[model samples]
Target: MVDARGLSCPMPVLMTQKAMKSKEDYYEVLVDNKTPCENVTRFAESQGYKVAVEEKNGEYLLKISK
Candidate 1:
């Protein structure tokens, strides 16, 4: 799991992409802002990956599974 909260813009997606490069099953990302979440989801979707977005309190949870 990658906790990307407080990160801005493409960083979350970029970091997640890097983290998932070595992953073969599932990954989870946590972002405080919606834009980063959206960007991450977009990046994941572009790669033909499945992502689930959920809100817990004020934070966003993005889970990508292969």
Candidate 2:
């Protein structure tokens, strides 16, 4: 899992992208705000992964898979 919580915009997306380089079929990204969540989701989707977001408390958990 890429823990992007407490991080800002491009950082979350960058972290997610770095994790994706592992060539895994599935990845999980945790972000504290909606902007990072949406940004990461878009990045993952653009890379051909399907993104599913879940909200817990005030954070977002993004499940990205091919």
Give one digit per residue, the lDDT tens place, for model 1 in 1-66: 889999998899899889878956788999999899999999988877899999988899998886
lDDT of each: 0.89, 0.92
lDDT at position 19, candidate 2: 84
- Supply candidate 1's per-residue lDDT for 14: 91
lDDT per residue as tens, model 2, 1-66: 999999998999988888888899999999999899889989999999999999999999898999
TM-score of 2: 0.97
Residue-level error in angstroms, candidate 1, position 51: 0.7
- Model 2 scores a C-alpha lDDT of 0.92
Locate the minimum summed-lDDT window of 10 residues in model 2.
14-23
Question: Once superposed on the true structure, which residue ranges of model 2 sit more than 4 Å away at CA?
Answer: none
Best by lDDT: 2
lDDT of 2 at 29: 94
